[model samples]
Target: MRIKDLFLLLLLFSSLLVNAQQKEIDSLENYYHYSQDAKRMEICLELSALYRNIDPSKGLEFAKEGITLARHFKDLKTEAAILNEMGVLYRKLGELDKAMLYHKDALVIFKSTNDIMGQAYCFSNIASVNIDMGYYEMALEYANRSLELKKKLGDENQIAYSLRIIASIYHESGRYSEALPYYNQAMDYYERLNNKTEKANVMLNKAIASSSLHDDFTPEIVDSLFSQAQIIYERVGSKYGVAAVHFHRADWEVRVENYTAAEQYYLKVLEITKEIDAKVLYLKALEKISEFYEIIGRNQTAYDYLSEYVRLQKELFSESKAKEVASIESRILLREQEQEIDVLEAQQKTRNVIIVMIFVLLIAIVLFLLFFNQRYKEIKRLNNKLNDEVTHRRKSEEKLKESEEQLKVLIEDKNRFLSIISHDLRSPFSGMYGLIYLMEEQYDELSDEKIKEIIDRLSKSSSQINELLEDLLSWANLSSGNIVFKPEIFNATKLINEVVDINTYRLQTKDISCRYDSSTQFIRADYFMVKTVFMNLLTNAIKFSDSNSQIEIEREIIDDRIVFSIIDHGIGMNEDALKKIQQPGKHVSKSGTMGEKGSGVGLLLVYDLLKKHGSQPEFSSSPGEGTTVKFSLPVK
Candidate 1:
């Protein structure tokens, strides 16, 4: 525990850490004393990166100074390399536009010098920034540019890096199909190079593509990729990369719905990310945990997760996106102006000689042949590409048309069936009425007591039949899209009372005390549509209640909306029974308490009617306990 002992212990720890980074460190150290200033600048940039975490401000300062020195010494190659390094650091610092500016500047310089490898690196860097910024179109453009440059230069390593950047963009943007080929290419190149670290990075990207597509990620390629990334990350002493590896592993497990393993890996990523101060990685970890909790029906945990997510979102988006976009455009304009000035100078130097050499007939013949061949090839290629696209589009259009026709046929059939059933049912019930009338007329003196009973039976049966017919027609009207939604102001409290009065006999039959504590809020809704919902719900509650059971009706104004609920502690449905409840026109009659038969069309009609006005009943119920059905009415 002595000072010397502590120092030695620290030294030993440092040695262990550097041992992992020794390969990169040694390569950089050797490059430091190289003969050229460009080579020296390359080493300095890497050194700055290695120390970025231990001291960020110093690292940034060192990288900037190296870039300046490279530029001052007229070492364009070194300048381009240093710019890429600065871009990477700026990207880590969350300065996306600044990173892009540096990368683009380097790209222009590299192209001027015909430094193809440098140009490819710059393109990849710019593409990465675009990906993070959600500019997927621009990202793909830069990625393709990088690929072209790398392929022409025949620098396989740079080509691999280009492919990796492209795959990362596609993977991040939820484009699995587009991403797969790029990952495969990157992986192939890394394998050929035997570059363990880069190979692992590419492998992780491939795994990510698979996971995004929801492919089965078992102990095969997924595990292999994760293990490879872990190894290479540890070998390079890159905590950030290590965190990424852990995050990917956790995400892979999440896709397979394995929450426990995902949670463990997320925790590991969190622990390492804290030391590295990687805010983005921390946000990603929080998002993954939130999604996992939601699948298990943990609402409170999901809420907490979303809160953190929204907080991070505000931090990223609420600041200066417009300013950054404008600044980039302004810079592009300035560069174009400079290019115009350069072009004018070149024209001045070549004008006289170019004019003296002009030939008419031979040039015209050459141009004609060139244009003819080019036009033919262009047309052929376009036709070949568009043939399948046109066919697929035609098929999609036909499917849509067929679906519409089927829907129309189904609607017509339902209307016809309703008309037939209602007409037939009415005739039979009407015939019984005629028979009773004839019996009363012919045998008026049969018996006074028997006559009284027959009249009562006639009244009850007629009432029941009328109620059934009303419900069936109401449902039919709503289903055939004949219901009108005319929003008007009405006192909802008074409306409920009116519905209560209309159904008084049904309520009185069950001896149920109907409690109404309506809110004093006037609502803007379709009057008839809202009334239908209230009456149907109240009737159902009364029908299901046992004798002397109290039906509680309540209303409230919450969050600028009218909420009316009928809560009854009666024969509530189990979940299975609730699932069988039909939509409009799907209901069959069922007997209520006191032998009062139900018109199932009432509920189905209510559901359809309420939904037309952008509202529907929500329910909470338990078997033998109760039910609460409420609807939300929009306010003016």
Candidate 2:
């Protein structure tokens, strides 16, 4: 390749890497430095318009900060101005109650100050709040109020805000006929203002309503809406807007059952969301991905992403942490209230106490007797409760310790039994096999076919005995605490191959075809132990299935673990069988789908091996449809 060609190739590769990412750094920078004062709440308002697309959190943050400062400075005008932004934030946060509280607060202040425009905006907020809370009548009333006020103020541009809220109310209230006109009206107002972002938002909202309400939702309409949203987002340099558009597009993809397309859009959304620190959107995106993966039976992958999302949520909205912060703020407010109350109360108490002292001067003897009895009774009651609690805790601890000791002893005894079975049983089987072979040769009065048949029968019996011995030995080795698992980086693909090979004879006889799929990512696991698990499950699957049945072997990494699933379209058990499988040694042996007999030991060995190696044996099966067994080991 020429040098120019190499440079061009590098550029293409770099573009490919970042093609899905948002590049709105400049817009984000422009938004950060606006003022939030009375004369400049207009600047704050402008920033809200910009921030909704670029970084909504930062927008909310700035708007809320202005609300705090405005309230602190007692500037009703500025405080009232942030109501719209506050509603937007609360709606996105999914806390419709808090959103309602802020909107109503602004309304009360604006109404008291006789600010018609601010009050009108508050009506719009109220309408949106009512819509989310499922109060259609209340929502419609507020929406109409906002429209009337907007017309009176002759603010045609602001009328669009009221129209959008009304449209949402109508959509949610099941009045599609009413909603469509309002949506179009809102879009037209935006067009008049030359506001591309608002126009796109309106169009997108219409698409959502149409798709959600109609069973046969047309793809063309959704595509058109998303295309408009994407262009507007790009035009305004808004990563948050781009993320939102991608997220919606992903939802549409899922509606069409195009999981691959959905995944691509979800990934794009995550990239943009992460870049913009759009945590709320990021959380929602991760959850959507989890659902998609789960639908396709990628449980492990679903689990991993769900775990991360849950972790982030716990970090973000920890009730205990929020309460702690609230407590700190509340305490300051309480202390100030207390100081004021104390001052007033102290003076009143002083006057009342003087009169009480005069009146009590004659009743001191009676009061002393009453105070002494009350104090003694209260202290005794508290002491008794404390003693009872301590005694209860002591008994609970003792029982827990006893249970732990019993479990430890049971595990040790189980390991000892396994060792004995491996050693003692193998010795007798070896001796019996040797004696049978000698007899076969010495007693040659039988024909050649008879001798061959006897030898083969003995060999199959011996092999079954040997397999059992191996399982017990493996279990004992793991239980002995001497099976050091020095994890080496290995291809799960190759490990699965080797496991499938071990089951080849069984599979071929039954006409069961096993399928294996893997990714390039290497998983760190105890290779031998993991391989043993795969071998056991595969063997079980093939054994259970009839001739011409299919067995699928699935493997995937979910977060920090490697999961393997063996699924067979074979003779499956019901819920009762599932219960028996949990405690492996308890189930009776049954013939395979191909008339192959089992030691009933296969499941026992699998359970023991998994228990020893540290993976949970999980399965779900019916009477005849199929069986699936899954096990997962931690990835290093």
The per-residue C-alpha lDDT of model 2 at residue 576 equals 79
After superposition on all CA atoms, what RMSD does each candidate show versus the true structure?
29.3, 32.0
Model 2 clash pairs are none
Best by TM-score: 2
lDDT comparing candidate 2 with the true structure: 0.68
Pull out the clashing pairs in model 1.
none
For candidate 1, the TM-score is 0.36
Instruction: Indicate the worst ten consecutive residues by lDDT in candidate 1.
Output: 1-10
lDDT for each residue of candidate 2 in 1-636, tens digit (9 for 90 to 100) = 112222232233233233233334344345546533454555555565455533455456557567766777788887777876777666755558878887888888899899998888888878877876789889899999999999899898889988887886777666665787899899989999999877877776776666665565577876887888788878988666677778777887887788898889999988987887767678778877887787888878877776667556545544534544343333333333444456486733322322332233224324434543463453244233334335434654574566457555545545445444556455547766775877767776777777787677677767777776677556544543437766677777888888888878888877778877855546667778778778777877887887887888787778788787889988899897778777654534566765554545556556665765577788889988989888876665
